[model samples]
Target: MTKKLLKSASRCIAALALTGAAGPTWAVESVKIAGFTWPGYGFWHIAAEKGLAPDLDIQYQTIEDPYESFNLVAAGQLDVVSSTAEFTPVGVERGLPVKLVAFGNLSYGTDKIVAGPGIETAADLAGKEVAVLEGGLAQIYVAMWLEQNGAAYDSVTYRNIIADDAFAAMIGGGVAASEFWEPYGTNTLKALEGASVLAQSKDPYWLQSGVIADGHYMSDALINDRRDVALLTMKAMYDAIAWWKQNPDEGNRIIAGGMSMSLADVELVIGKNGTGLDGGLYVYDFMEAAQFCGSAPGNPPFDQKNGQINDHWNLVSGWWVKFNLIEAAAPPETGIDCSLHKELYDSGYRG
Candidate 1:
């Protein structure tokens, strides 16, 4: 399973025009966000709970299914969404009025490929029934592992299932292997006797590979009309990140409560699972994110090609076409827009 990873504009000119021809209209004062049940995306809750963006009247909700959130945004019911970054290209292909605004976190050690007893290697996964959230990062994940280990990509049967269900299936004797993110992956390892992790995102190879990330995406309605709202939203995110950095323990509790996950689960997501593999979510703090936004001197080391979003945008868009996950390749610009982040960073906002 992959838990993967907004707006505004005009007015004054039209107000002056009202004395002559016409008046301008402003965007909504409220910001409604739909996010998934992942700790990385939980910062929105912190932003809302702590009144980080009080002027925007920010409201956030947790929707377990990512597609539901995308649909809601497409239908104009939501202003923005926090989801896996891979879907941004898919959304653009389908003509969804969405653009990736800022990245949330690197999967780091979160995404994992776990196999039941008796499967020892990626090649051993051949002919096994592998469960993954189809068309999402999970499939890409398993495929990358298989390819890296010299296994045929089509060697196994691919079952499209959510991570939680896949975990249940793995436990109940259906899937021989499944891709999962923590704490599901950790929980599965603890629950099943002899089950082993086949591949982990935290592994040096995958971490340096720059294959996956989580992000925040906004609708055109939000980006085009309410840019002020969008900027404020990004500021709130950095503020939340800063707050969490200074108060990790309390922040984890807030994330757990807001995400409806247990504190242990939050710990697992934050890389406190004690696996000692440098695992856990690599949440970029304000300065780090600004650098990743290409707004600073040194970009994140994960992708050295510049930053996480740019590299993955190029990588995923190509892979999506190669895998036929999308009809054709969409321009990286169509899916990702880091200008908002640059604007905020340049403003010298401490948080």
Candidate 2:
């Protein structure tokens, strides 16, 4: 057995040996997690601060580069990572031993395709350089917009730039357009003359697509060797979301404090209002996500059909293939492990 499995067995034996005595004392499992500094990914901070999973030592590292986070997970340096939902297929195609275990939240209107001055339409961007975090959801979003607007997917040259750099490129007139989220998207519009949003994620097409979203990924080792820890970690995430629903102010404060972001900036993504989608993201509660994953029996909110995770996975895989990010599409089951959601639902976890 793996070291983690042996350790778990030992812990169980110890707990059984202590039956009918004082409360069993077991060693806390140390779960290392990483994510970029985004408000949507900050829920892990809430899970930590609130002590939702007391049995697990949640160590969350803020690594701005999500690709690095995935690298760490593949290298056995991290257990879980919260990141954009669309990368699982890419990871699978690259032979990374990482799988997306749960869908966290959806972008309501936080993500935008912003065009710089003199770029009036999709056709205008042809032969021009557009900025995006190449091999990411931003690239897919922009490509989708282009195709929908009668332009070929490869019409524009893609500059593989991060959002912050993309913002600067927009202001400096270095690129015709870029994909951005939250403060950067809004700020680009404010900073550049004639800059306008070409498309927002909250639109019916984008919402139904569910492409712009966040999720939790776990290394194959964690899911296979430390199943209990994986389940507990996933539950703790929902527990944090439940607490946030009840205490939005405190939760937002905690998120902002942990992320070193302004409260206003955090609110712009997560929202101050009690409604989850009032801000920029539609934070999925446990049950709603279960529905999306087809672990439960009902349609997800926003008119999304149940079991849409399969569709979303295939859709992203198709885009990755088109962009040459992956040679071919892998089966959705290879990248997504919805059994965690199913287990949680079977255990009567409603939120």
Candidate 3:
């Protein structure tokens, strides 16, 4: 290729990029994202290492806890985040400006309300102690499930506990029943021989239909603030998810390493309740999610009829209001902004 011809081709590509030809334009600056300490965000690591985001700069930071991680993103220090569906509303209330872009994975059968061998059924849990992280999605889900089954949710003792300490409490037999997600749930059941699933949060009940799973979140300000770059990042993430779906063995290995678990353990986690470990990214038609969530008010940011999950937020928020965790009436609505995801969807940018 002669220098002149090469230069001509480069100019054509540049002109096309500048004119928004072929696909959505990409931002030229580097993108910094705050990711949680979990395997769901492993795709970013893989995509970055594989040079998937060659056109856009990608930076990853480890946020050991979700609370601090989302807070930072809301503060505009980070661009992207990952967490369950239960958090979008919370983010909105806290002024985070985060939006659900794509889903990663739901708990499937990973989360559970389990009791030591003695407390067999949900009915038996009345008056028994149940350990859980207070004010989290898990607690509310457990409560709702109990209520649905005619169990006395208030009758059970609720203990506020963190994830790290949850295992110890369950194993040492400090709590009769406990609500938790995997691999902690797996570890607890394994460590306690007498433990039995009082209620499993399997699909279609506890964590599905766009309700309980790991979803990709991006800042609305980042997209509207930097449109070209946000679109490109979405393309890059789609590539990452498609890449993993095609290579589960390798993908599992990477995610397992990221999660500090053995590959077999990762496999077990994915295998929770027959859930398929398909590639984590989805490139749905722009209006598809609106159909899914009923958010299609005007082509973008379609209706997210996620009352099931939203109810959890209100329940917890009310508890907080009652317990003084937050102000009585101010719900955190600023934290979640779906406009960016809605824009990409409405723009028909699948890449």
Candidate 4:
């Protein structure tokens, strides 16, 4: 029999052997989960590859776009998605019935504002045309950078385009600068002679606030009907993190193959001890996540605070509202849920 069928059979036998009480003490529930093509999100693939949640039936897919993934969740075609946390407010405002269940990683230096040759500082960006992925994290990064650098929000021209297009624009001299992440930043610096990064999210000001973290969210339907499955799914994610910690090299290979990214690129994102890509992104382990979501009591080391997810959401959601990315900032109670991580941790889910 297939694994699902075998699991079902075992559960049925156990229930019958126990006098068929018809209680809530059954086996796992089938879950449908998806996420974009990012290293942090790819950890779910680790769960699948290692059979971490053998009792639960998990269906994971790769959906490149966050909006599309949430749309699927809204239509009941998907149960959960690992995506950028900035979209939580937008999803709530649009009535998507999704919740930010847990955070994944903090973009240490992945996102950047790259300037072409002859632009040395943030002030140089004044009056110059800059490209960004409008209505996405790029816009938010650039906006926050400009504001922090004593530059006016409208000091420069904003060209909204896709990341690849923005890269092309910067290379062709169509725009003086653009927001880029990962290989894109590496590519821009290599392709354009004398190009440099003016600002990045890794700085203490940005990193300490947890403004650019990735997240895993579940649909209301799944959280309501299959709460146990939701808990099991999260437990699998934590298990994957623990496994990756003890086996970084092998884990990177699995993630690279599963996400269709090069091993080198995967290393760039995962970085040793959260210092990858010259401080690109800081990968959060299960313990760190528990503290971040306020599910774990007390603050562990590593500059993280308990219950910071809601605070971070408030900061980013306010920015979204100010930039008109969403209609309004949604309350934390509407979407943020840290209790899931806490419950698993308390239950001794070290993995």
Candidate maximizing TM-score: 2
lDDT sort, best first: 2, 4, 1, 3
- Mind giving the per-residue lDDT tens digits that candidate 1 earns over 15-134? 557757544444546889988888888888777788777676778888878889999988999988988878988888888888988767877788889999999987788888999988
Per-residue error for 331 in candidate 1, Å, reads: 1.8
Segments in model 4 whose C-alpha atoms lie over 4 Å from true places: 1-28, 272-279, 300-302
Q: How far does residue 214 in candidate 1 sit from its true spot (Å)?
A: 0.8
* Model 4 alpha-carbon miss at residue 37, Å: 1.5
**lDDT at position 248, candidate 4:** 75
TM accuracy, model 4: 0.88
Q: How far in Å is the alpha carbon of 28 misplaced in model 4?
A: 6.0
How many angstroms is residue 25 displaced in model 1 relative to the true structure, after the best TM-score fit? 21
Question: Per-prediction count of colliding residue pairs?
Answer: 15, 0, 19, 4
After superposing all C-alphas onto the true structure, candidate 4 shows an RMSD in angstroms of 6.0
TM-scores, each model vs. reference: 0.87, 0.92, 0.75, 0.88
Judge candidate 3 at residue 49 and give its lDDT. 70
Question: Could you say which candidate leads in lDDT?
Answer: 2
Model-by-model lDDT, in order? 0.79, 0.91, 0.63, 0.81
- The lowest-lDDT stretch of 10 consecutive residues in candidate 4 is 271-280
